[model samples]
Target: MTRSELIAQIKQKKSFLCVGLDTDLTKIPEHLLDEEDPIFTFNKAIIEATSDLCVAYKPNIAFYECYGLKGWESLQRTATILPKDCFSIADAKRGDIGNTSKMYAKAFFDPQVSGFDFDSITIAPYMGKDSVTPFFEFKDKWAIVLALTSNEGSADFQNIENAEGVQLFEQVLEKVNSWGSIENTMYVVGATRGEAFLKIREHAPDHFLLVPGVGAQGGSLSDVCQYGMNKDCGLLVNSTRNIIYASKGTDFAEQARIEAQKLQKEMQIELEKAGIC
Candidate 1:
């Protein structure tokens, strides 16, 4: 989806919620195991239940990749079932040598190969521009580079001082923005690091931020928007465990919808406060 279309969705839904499909076969309802593909069966129901309450869906690739070929096939089927208007993301965190990165791009962006046709892919910037630019070449797709993550380990590298003492993530944001415009580029900012939102806004005031660390991670939605929002409501606040895994029973999907609705209702209030609706 384009920037305008995303913003329009945020406006239309009165939400900036992004639901994470971190589906784990081990945790789904026992009854679903009787289905041909339990993971896809669970995902389809969850998407049907909560698609209207969210503006995007992010399927973290690790959950599926860990299960091997069956896991991959499940991901393909899940992606096919997502609502068309909701922006889809493959939180693959992929970046490698230029040639390998090209293949990764083809894997995710080439609708023929993966059947994902995701609007965005999370990419690590440690390897620098050559590893990132290949993904940017795809038309209307996005390269969401990692910036300040929400994990405690983020302090280990992302906050390290440079020669001038500027944090590493700050430099990453500034340098990466030169590689692509705000229209096609975005940064991943963890919600747990809400304090850094103001600093990030100072660096890329108009760019969209794919925010994780909410819900189960304990990041406050209100705090993130207080400092991170632009006039366009440039934030996609994501929740994973707290929503999709809300219940491990046959009513799991209905339970997921309840969790999503709670977040969307909260988001609607935030949007109203920001005059975004």
Candidate 2:
């Protein structure tokens, strides 16, 4: 979706919640195993339950890639059914050589070639511009580069300071923002690093941020909004296991809805406070 469309959805839903489909076969409801495609079945139900409460859905590719062909089919089904107005992201975290990056872009953005269409793809910027630019070639698609991740290992590289006294992630923000605009580029700013949001905003005042690690990871919603929110409500806070795996029983979907509703309500209040709604 385009930038205006995404902002419109955030206003219409009074939310910026991004539901993560980090579906694990072993962790899903036992009863769903009887279905032809348990993962898709679970995802369909989850989408049906939380569609109105969220503005986006992100499916981590590894979850299905490990399952192979059957898993791919399930992802295909999930992608096909995703609500058009709700942004869809392939949380693949892919970036390679220039030519290869183009293929990756086609895989996620071109449904005819890859059997699924994603509004955006997560990218690792370790290889620099050529590795990341291919994804931006597509209209209305986005390249969400990794900035400050939620993982502990990120401290090893992302926090390393340069000779200029700027940290690696800060440099990344400046460089990546130069390649794309606020319209098609976004950064992955982990909610767990709430304190970093202020610094992040200084560099990316207008760009949208796709934040993870809120639910199940102990990140505070209030803390994230306080620092990360922009005039357009430029944040897509994602919750994975805490919502999708809310229960491993027949009541799973209902439980997921409850979790999503809780977040949406909190988001609505934040939007109101920021005068964004």
Candidate 3:
């Protein structure tokens, strides 16, 4: 999706919500296990329930990779069923040597090769430009680079400062921006880093941010919008556990819709407040 198309979806839905499909087999409803493919079954229902309430869907690659072949089959089915109007993301934090990175890009962006054509994929930029640039080679696809993450150990490296006093993440923002345009590049900014958005905006005022760590992670929605929102409502706040795992019964999909609706309502208010809708 282009930037204009994405912005249009945000306005049309009155939301910038991105639902994470970190679907775990063990966590799904017990009844679903009886199905031929429980993971895709659960994902299909969840998508049917919440597609209108969200602008994007993110499937964390590890969740399926752990199951081997069956897991991969489930991911393929999930990818195929994703709503066309909603942006799809392969939440695979892949980054390696240039050649390997190209393969990774083909795996996600080349539908004929891997049966998965995501609108974007999460990338680890520690390997620098060559490792991260391959994904951008695919037209209209995005490279969502890891920057200020929400994990406890993120401070160990991302927060380290250089001799010039610029933090590692700050430098990452500056360097990565040069590799791609705002239309195709985005940063993974944890919602937990609320006030840090003020600093991030200085280096990336117009770029979109794929924000995680909200809902179950306890990050404040208001704080993220207050500091991070741009005129285009440049944010895709993701929630996984709090929505998909809302219940473990037959009403799981219904409950997920309820949870997603709650976030959508909150997002609508933020959009209105910012004059973005």
* Prediction-by-prediction clash tally: 0, 0, 0
Report the C-alpha lDDT of model 2 over 88-145, residue by residue, as the tens digit.
9999999999999999999999978887789999999999999998998999999999
> Between 1 and 2, whose lDDT is larger?
2
Looking at candidate 3, the ten consecutive residues that score lowest on lDDT are 109-118
For model 2 the local lDDT of residue 103 reads 96
- Candidate 1 structure quality by residue, lDDT tens digits, 144-196: 99999998898899999888989999999989998998988999999996778
Winner of 1 and 2 under TM-score: 2
TM-score (all chains, Cα) for each model: 0.98, 0.99, 0.99
After best superposition, candidate 1 residue 191: deviation in angstroms? 0.9
Compared to the true structure, candidate 1 yields what TM-score? 0.98
Ranking by lDDT: 3, 2, 1
What TM-score, to 2 decimals, does candidate 3 have?
0.99
**Model 3: per-residue lDDT, tens digit, 43-66?**
999999999999999999999999
Higher-lDDT candidate of 1 and 3: 3
lDDT, candidate 2, at 168: 97
For candidate 1, which ten residues in a row score worst on lDDT?
A: 111-120
Which pairs of residues collide in model 1? none
Off by over 4 Å in 3: none
RMSD of each: 1.0, 0.7, 0.7
